[model samples]
Target: MRSFVRAGYNLRKKTGKWELKVRPDKDSMLGRGLLSEKEYHDPVRVFRKAFKEYRPEQFLEFLAEAVHFSLGPFNHAPEGNLIGPYLHLVKMIDAAWLIVERASAEK
Candidate 1:
């Protein structure tokens, strides 16, 4: 759950009734650096809460959006260190697979 990319990525996605808003500027190097000084909100909590409330199809959509928001910038940005994020990404995918497997077994 903790990774340099997750910690250094500061852009927040705002989901409004029918719209999603993002401010790329907030994810700048300086902005991300400041996060080290304060508490950073982990988006996994948002997804976890949504999973409990959303229907299966709705949860899929929400999950897709979450992955895109979390990984898109990390993938496209230039980075000197990729090992940490790469490992974290693999772990995240494995965790998602486990969730799917457990859910499928219950049905």
Candidate 2:
């Protein structure tokens, strides 16, 4: 219910089903919808709130290593099968390269 990709939790569709492992984020719309308007408008505050649930270390690792897929695999990926993470990496790269560039700028 936290939209497509809520950042803190990864939403996956395996056999036509959606799974949310962590909590429903009580402040989000899909959750309890109890956040103040100021919190809703502040990007930094929002990111901090989201990061509280997700691991920022993993995020940093993603930024550092995913940019180099041609280099090697990420040995520190979350414990699970590799396909999901790889697919997510491809999706993130594609979005940044294909969508953001066209939608926002010529670069």
Q: Note the clash tally of each candidate.
A: 0, 0
Give candidate 2 misplaced runs (Cα > 4 Å): 1-40, 70-107
Model 2: worst 10 consecutive residues (lDDT sum): 11-20
lDDT of 1 by residue, 26-97 (tens): 445443322221111233333333334433343334445556667756555432334433433443343334
Report the C-alpha lDDT of model 2 over 20-89, residue by residue, as the tens digit. 2234345455321333444333323333444454444555454445455547765665443345344444
Q: Which pairs of residues collide in model 2?
A: none
How far residue 30's Cα lies from its native spot in candidate 2, in Å, is 22
Each prediction's Cα lDDT score? 0.36, 0.37
| Candidate 1 lowest-lDDT run of ten | 11-20
